[model samples]
Target: MRGTPTLLGRPVPLGEVAWLTVVWLLLWGDLTVGNVLGGLLASSVVVWLLPLPTLDSGVRIHPVAALVFLVRFAADLVLSSFRVAFWALRLGTSPPVETVRVRLRTSSEVMTVLVTVALSALPGSLVLEAELEDRELVLHVLGIRGDVRATVQADVTRLEGAIVAAFGTPADREEIR
Candidate 1:
């Protein structure tokens, strides 16, 4: 039977080792020879001691699209920050808020997670729950006015499209377009 692939007779994936080593170096805030060697040893030992089953997550990054997504997200973040600040400083009345349920077109776990994190990072919106089976996200959103639900839905859809364009599988990218 075929078993897990190994390097130098050890079940350690080079990609994981390299990534862990980078993380180690960042944690130490240094990039010395000793630190590099220590990182390599620590990462190798961690991977060997705690083996994890490999599964294809079907995610790929398109640099151009990723840049576009980042730019748009930054703009959204800035705009949302201003909106939330205005609401906070406004008089006695609170901004109209509601729990909005958004149905996602793509059900990929990676896409779902990306969407959740992106939405939650914005000031006026917070993702309360993600129903994987239903491919839905329940979000608590502030500053709801006329037709705000439609606007929020459209915003989420646009965000999903951006994410799918940036780092989704081939099928996901096509479906999103």
Candidate 2:
């Protein structure tokens, strides 16, 4: 009998442990210098001692793109809040419900997840799933009327573009296309 293959052929779950340590530090650490030092020591010790899986990644520091994303996110939140409030005030009327599939351009799992979460936070749309094989997203929308497909498509495009600008490399943009 052969054993099932694990991530990178290692049985160790390093990523999970690292994530747990980070969460613990964030949740339990006091906002004092002593506590900060203690937390850092604890986290460092745990990270150093644990046998973890390794994965490669990169980070980008794009100030202008980050600012643009933040501004758009805030604006969307405000707009969605008003739309929800309006719908709530109108009570008992039939809301136009529609299911729209958004085709995502970016293949990065993190970027795709971010887009899903952001869209779901908006008042009208909820992301049900991401079809990874086909790069499509299923969303349930409320009060969608007159060309919902185009609107959803446009929204997805804008989000992908913003994410690419903020965090993607030149290679990532090519992958998205």
Candidate 3:
């Protein structure tokens, strides 16, 4: 059972609800029932109308682990922001740009997609393409340095590990081999 719970063939995760409600509250700027219900209704409609792929790769969110991932991701985001700012401010110093291939550890399409999205969100890196056939991702990095190849590879692996630890079942963790 993943974090997303299904009701009447509709998937609704708590995060989705919170996000929707918060957006609605911010927009309406109130705590009235109408706004709350409106947000819930809107979220429900979207969740029901848009069909998301069902992930059956034994993904289950561990609350603590997921929280840990969130914390680390936030910290990384702050650090990445600073690095990106530095790159923007620097003059006449073109960072080494290169495309690196990273072999993903998982065969699960869900994990691959998750990792790809996560890595893409990091500054200076973009997932150019993923070869699901070989479970590898071709990444374009702007300002790579210090054994960039190994660093990128390790970063991908670490992100994948964090994701698996946070939202994968025991069997899935074992499959991390």
Candidate 4:
């Protein structure tokens, strides 16, 4: 089933095994026959014992859009870092922090997870909660004095657009729009 090789009437998840093996090798920082064999054995055991739910993921990288996404992400990271630092160093009362909920454009599991991670990575904003069923995110944002909800929602929407443009299929992009 799933075009995977069967072992004793069960499908072997070769992709998961290979990915786990690679991770093991990277962690061990060695690439030898013994390591390879051990990784394979260990990964096979883990895959069989602790099976993960299969997901389509639906990720496809578009070079141009990916580059754009990376550039924008880097810029946001840097700018937000500085803004947080400035807020920290400033004298007087603390900046206002507000929690807001923003509805996302797409609700694909992969897309939702990516957006959540991106928002958390930025310095001034953190994803407090992700409601996948409702296609929404609850965020805690710092240093916003005016129209906090709108600003946070717009930022999340833009980030979601960039992510969809970079890795989403045509249908996925349409869902976001």
Candidate 3 per-residue C-alpha lDDT over 15-102 given as tens digits, one digit per residue, 9 for 90 to 100: 7677877898899988999999999888777766775665665578899989988988888777777777788888977767889999
Candidate 3 Cα deviation (angstroms), residue 12: 15
Better of 2 and 4 by TM-score: 4
Q: What TM-score does model 2 achieve against the real structure?
A: 0.69
**Range of the 10 consecutive residues with the lowest summed lDDT in candidate 1:** 1-10
TM-score between model 3 and native: 0.68
| Whole-model lDDT per candidate | 0.90, 0.73, 0.82, 0.90
**Candidate 3: stretches off by over 4 Å:** 1-58
Q: What does the lDDT come to for candidate 2?
A: 0.73
Stronger candidate by lDDT (1 vs 2): 1
TM-score of 1: 0.76
What TM-score, computed on C-alpha atoms, does each candidate reach? 0.76, 0.69, 0.68, 0.72
RMSD of each predicted structure: 4.1, 8.1, 6.2, 4.3
Candidate 1 residues 53-88, lDDT tens each? 878878899999999999999999999998889999
Q: How does residue 102 of candidate 4 score in lDDT?
A: 97
Clashing pairs in 3: none
**Candidate 3 RMSD to the real structure:** 6.2
Rank the models by lDDT, top first.
1, 4, 3, 2
Residue 103 lDDT (model 3): 92
Query: In model 3, where is the ten-residue run with the lowest total lDDT?
Result: 50-59
Q: In lDDT terms, how accurate is model 3? A: 0.82
